[model samples]
Target: MRKLITDRRLLFGYILAHLFIFFTFEQEKVFWYIFTATMLILISYSILDETEQRESRKFHLFIGILSGALLYGVFWIGDILIDLLKLPLSNQITALFKLFSPELTWHYLVLFLIIVPGEEIFWRGFIQKKLLTHTNPWTSIVLSTLLYASVQIHSGEFVLILAGLTGGFVWGILYAWKRSIRLVIISHLVFDLLLFWLFPLR
Candidate 1:
């Protein structure tokens, strides 16, 4: 509890995440520009703050890809369930895509190569990793998930916030289990690949 208030790096990183993410979602100027900038900055900070171990390259790739595919499947089912229930989330989902979806070729490129990696490295590799040092795995994962979801609140889209919570929980567990930044990064990369380009939810 004391660490949560006194840890400067944790507080600074989360506060920065909120500012950047809020700018990405709320600014009407241009989404990609702000979003890309945010990722770059956060990723830089993560790399400097987190020290990750490199081990079992092939195993990480295998599990990461597999988990990503499974995660996407979970979302697909969730999407179907939401549809079946006739939830009033169509507009919110559509708005989420409109505001942040990749249209141009480079948008996909950046999302895969930079933005996804940036998010995984920062949120899971750095933030969650920090939380683990101060709490149990379950508690750390939940805390990280909440902080991760909180950044999406400025979007004012419940679905988007929910997505953040769900995805963050998965990645948080992966990081805690494997303690490999590469593994989670690969998982995130694969998940975004399917979600954004191959089979977008919206």
Candidate 2:
């Protein structure tokens, strides 16, 4: 824990993420602008930090698409359970969707082209992979997931934080296994497409 906190590069990345995400959520009117800027910053950092497998590989796209669909099913089941249990999360979830969901065509373009890839590359490919050297793969995954979830704290929506945890865990494991940014990026993009556009929970 101390080592992780002391690690300059990791610490820098975390601070950057938290700072930008905080700003991203704080300004609702210019949320998209801040969000886009945050992703760009992370993408720049990731490319400079390490050399990841960015090339397309065999079964990567296929597996990414399938895994994304499977993750969507997991969330779908969770949504059903939440409704069945009468959880007080629907409004929070709805609000988060309203804030983050792409309503314009350009929003979708930025989401698919910039946001998803930037997130996967930085969180799973860079941060999680960097954590691997300090601890076991599982520990790295969980820690990265926690860090990812923590960044969403400023959103003031429990559901969004939970989504960060859940999605981060899946992508963490995928990157640990595949070591392919392309794969995780595709998977994340597919998941976002389904959750935000094709079939939103709310």
Candidate 3:
């Protein structure tokens, strides 16, 4: 099981699975079923991929927090622009709010504990790390970033897709530079907290 999960091919397959479930599933309960299943698979693989270590350097932490703040600023500006422009993307926004409903439970548990950590582990720690072995670091980061954004294509919202692409690149570049999965994960968690709960675009 460990060997199987550690393979990059398996990780890529799981990435596709995330996209499939995210785009195709509509029923909330069904979505959660696949979401929880995929998250567990990725989390298990992350634990078993022992070649990488999740660093917790203080400098990385500081940078991570700063990165989160910067991302929040971008979101704030973008939200204002969206409102001013009257973009008809409410369905995309509604999906996000529903996913993070009753913040104490959904946002904290799902976003903070599971999704963010799992994503960083799989996308950065595993996928990009594997790609780096055979390609230029920047190339690997960019490819992984594109794949990261690809999953959100099913959102059927241009703004959401743009946000995913931009955020993936930022986080991907940070992970490539810092080599800190924990840092990227924390940065992502902070950004999600601010975007979804504290300063929601709505």
Candidate 4:
């Protein structure tokens, strides 16, 4: 574990990948998809060991649904806060909606099939797990959440940053306690569907 975290090559690769994602945010949607897929593959094979294949014993459908609901509730509060504050990110989000004027079905496909799952796989499955090697559990969770939020802040939207912060914190805690990649992925999917599609805050 110590050797893995301290390896200069892995550290450089990780930083490079994040910088790539930060710059690729405004690129074409196809580029976004490809980048995510590439990152997922790299992160999975590079850091994840055989232990990751063993699913979490704590996962349950009922708990996942409840957790999803609670996460969505956070977005609801975030929505109100954005409105009350009149954050400039509101305009950026609204612009984002226009920029990606895909059919509703395609939009849902992107969110569910690619973005949500890809993010969970990389962030929670890979990054958080890697962090655990060097830090205490709570520290791992908090650091991973901050890293997750940093990517969103590149959007130049405070509200988007807030959403990322809230979601990352919730998912980080869930993964730490439940230790379930499946559970965190499902909750993430639910949160994305609700916040971006069914009940967009902007």
**Can you tell me which runs of candidate 2 are displaced by over 4 Å?**
1-3, 51-59
- Taking all chains together, each candidate's TM-score versus the true structure is 0.92, 0.92, 0.79, 0.80
For 53-131, candidate 1 gives per-residue lDDT tens digits of 4333445889899999999999999888888898888677877777778889988888888898899888887888888
- For all candidates in order, the CA lDDT equals 0.85, 0.86, 0.71, 0.70
Model 4 lDDT at residue 110: 67
lDDT of 4 at 180: 83
lDDT of 4: 0.70
In the predicted model 3, the residue pairs found to clash are none
Best candidate, lDDT-wise? 2
Worst 10 residues of 3 by lDDT: 99-108
Clashes of each: 0, 0, 0, 0
Candidate 4, TM-score vs. the true structure? 0.80
lDDT of 4 by residue, 125-148 (tens): 777776766677798789889888
Residue-wise C-alpha lDDT for candidate 3, range 8-121, written one tens digit per residue = 674665566565557444545455545656666777765665554345364577888889879889878877776688877655666766763444465357767787788888
Error of 3 at 103 (Å): 4.4
The runs of at least 3 residues in candidate 4 whose Cα sits more than 4 Å from the true structure, single-residue gaps closed, are 1-13, 28-55, 100-104
